[model samples]
Target: MYATFPDLLRLLFVPALAWAAYHDLRVRRVPNELWYPFAALGLALLAWEYVLVERTSLFLVRAAVSLLVIPLAYLFWFVGGFGGADFKAFCVVALLYPTYPSYYLADLALPLVRTQLGVFSVTVVTNAMLASLGYPLALGLRNALAGVVSKLMFVGRPVAVRQLAAAHGSLLETPEGFSRGGLDLDALRMYLRWRGVTLGRLLAQPERYRDPATVPAETNDPGDGSVTTEPIPDPASEPAPREDADEYDDPWGAARFLDDIDSTAYGTTPRKLREGLDVITSQERVWITPGVPFIVPLFVGLLLALTAGDLLFALMRLIGLV
Candidate 1:
């Protein structure tokens, strides 16, 4: 679809909401002031899409759904981890994003993630529909043709006995050209040729196959049998325990995790007083936020929109009007 004014408005709300959610998920809190960017963007888009455009009919419908849904989504959140900011965010989005295309009825409204997660469960039925009406089996047809061709081939006459004997015995000869020397029969057997092919030298001539290059270093069984096939190092296999995985590489990481930001910051690397803009811009410790999910006030204005959208979506589905 074209990047209409409405679509452009919707795009404004995504990045800030995504960032807010990232921090909220990380630190369990979102800063109170962080909601401004999202609010400003969303309001601007809403004005453009709703006030300046011709989506008035859809607008009226969403307004009504908004009144009914705004309360319920917040209720579910307040009693749980969902905070006020997240609740409000959902409410705003419900009024905006979900208004497009009457999303509830469209065949492609939901994507694969939703489909896997049990939204619009017609997936299996669709696949079965294809299977029942699709092409006939291919394997049985191809094999039947091969069998017919094999039966039509003529057999050739047998060769002389001496020629056959030499073909079979040529595999055992090697350099020193001595017919063999200090022969390790195991290596010889391992390298044996088949179908008149030398099996790549060693199989053809064990006498010449003793070099380290030709005979892989590993193929040489350990002298004292100290290493009797130390299980093939499979790349798919888990590696031997990592050295750093067990070591305490970070001197202060553990302390930071348990302490609050202010407490941890006291012990953090102090800012360098260098006149050249200090070696680093800032080095706040992770103990408090450790990352963003661990941060507190884990709510953003858009969260309210997501839930409001979800519930608005669910209720619409219930009434078959979404």
Candidate 2:
């Protein structure tokens, strides 16, 4: 008979997956605070599943699954095929869902391979990988329908630089792996130097809120912390010549002119504004790479594995391959 998670176990595990997916989508990072606690709980639940439920045979099967899967997850991470969070997520999945969790529904149409293997986490991973194929395929189809080709190579269409920066996706590129709106590392370095702020400091304190206009550009060498530029200029006393364009400029618009020679004559522009200007100038158009958070696919995979069983197994059966 096929096995599944108990009701209590499902309740705990599903919510955790939902939370991880949300965090990964929003910030591209999941904090230790969320996963670490969930991991502890997962171990506890697995223990209970084995000891209290007295599913000794299932427990052994699950243990074997964990031994097989966790190392593979680690190997993916080690080989740079997986991100840190994605790797940890898989590890957690191995512990929490070593075998398919139970649902009190009629058995779904499953293939002979799955019935023979009966490893829950393996089916979930396979299903998620299969589901993920839809994203790029859809993007390619859209590009084909739109009559767009050449630079994007039918993987993605050229999008405006501003739009690309404001949105999120894997940036597309030519065969040479270059795109118009993609960040120009060399140009970015020069911009960062002129502003006298290092990327390290900016990242170290990303949460600090600052008015884009008011952030003072660094006058010190980020390399050795020595004075490299003049002190912050004051516009009140030595007013920089205002351009006619400044009259129509909003805060973001004003940022475009921050690098203007005359504007910096009176005062240093804000660091934040400088950064925005750098990004805007980085590229005119970009090929958005087709990538999605792996967690998203994994979450979908988990649900399908619970409701439908192994996708590849079912497909094989449908095609009379197994």
Candidate 3:
């Protein structure tokens, strides 16, 4: 048996985990190209151990345990529990480390630490899941210190109608206490599709957005509550009408974009700036979902699994509960 080769195995497993973590952190996805090769290599290595090294029993048992876990991972992804990349990463882990490698966690003295786990990848995932559970506490502490605890705690908070047009990760409220889907980026993207604007464009060049006065008006249907597809002339493009005053300043000004945010899903009305001016001007905040990317905690779990074995098992031993 190649006892020294475990160090080489660490080199194999850790690098792929690190690389996937990097891309997942950056773009919220890890490409299939990364995991696919690693998965194939893992299977090949397992095959070599079984056929060439003559460790048939160990190889079969390890592979069997890992294979059983795959369906559960797929089910999680199917139910929207996690992303595709996370599920694939688990599969790759199963292939790479079906059992605990001889080189890893050699110094740990915990009685519960197994030399070889039923499925080593399951331990890694369990550790990762436990690590992710701590994230909310971390976020709560961060928001508390930042003095946004009240805003963060509430599911929704009142914000100015003006801020609604530019808000991210937050929702807007109609005066009658219904929510507009401000945080729902998908719906907003659909709404912006007709304007030839993508989310990237909105983020990059918000100033280039069409003037609110120029947006084509839609006729409201009282029956089905659908807006009719009626094209209207852009008022800004029309010739100036004769007036007694030399200049008339629009009180609403740039905030006219707020009117377009009304959604049929919630049956929300376009809230006026004046209605919530008191709360908006004073609090100057809105409700936010405060979502964290799953990859960060997954990376942390990988590190802990390498050095600390199973986190819940370790904790049980520490408190003498086992």
Q: List TM-scores for all candidates, in order.
A: 0.31, 0.62, 0.60
For 1-322, candidate 1 gives per-residue lDDT tens digits of: 2346555555555575667666555433456676565556545655665667746775655545544445765775655434455665555454444343212223433221221122111222223223323122232344355552222112111122222211211111122222211122211221221111122322233222222122222222212111122332212221222233433332212222223122221122211111001111111110000111211221232332222323334445679784
Q: Highest lDDT: which candidate? A: 2
Please say which candidate is ahead in lDDT: 1 or 3.
3
Q: RMSD in angstroms, candidate 1?
A: 26.6
lDDT of each: 0.32, 0.56, 0.52
The TM-score obtained by model 2 is 0.62
**Which regions in candidate 3 have their CA more than 4 angstroms from the true location?**
1-7, 54-58, 104-112, 115-117, 151-195, 198-285
Error in Å for residue 143 of model 1: 48
Lowest summed-lDDT stretch of 10 residues in model 2?
A: 219-228
Give the top-scoring candidate (TM-score): 2
User: How close is each model in CA RMSD to the real structure?
Assistant: 26.6, 11.5, 10.3
Clashing residue pairs found in predicted model 3:
none
What is the alpha-carbon lDDT for the whole of candidate 1? 0.32
Off by over 4 Å in 1: 101-322
Q: Write candidate 2's Cα lDDT for 1-322 as tens digits.
A: 3444454454566777888888777655576666676677767777787787757886687668765777898898776465678888887777766655554435643322354576677888898899988876777778878787664544556677544323444344433445533332222333344344444433333222112342333322212111223342222321222333333223322344345323231222444343444444445665655335688899988778777788898898899898
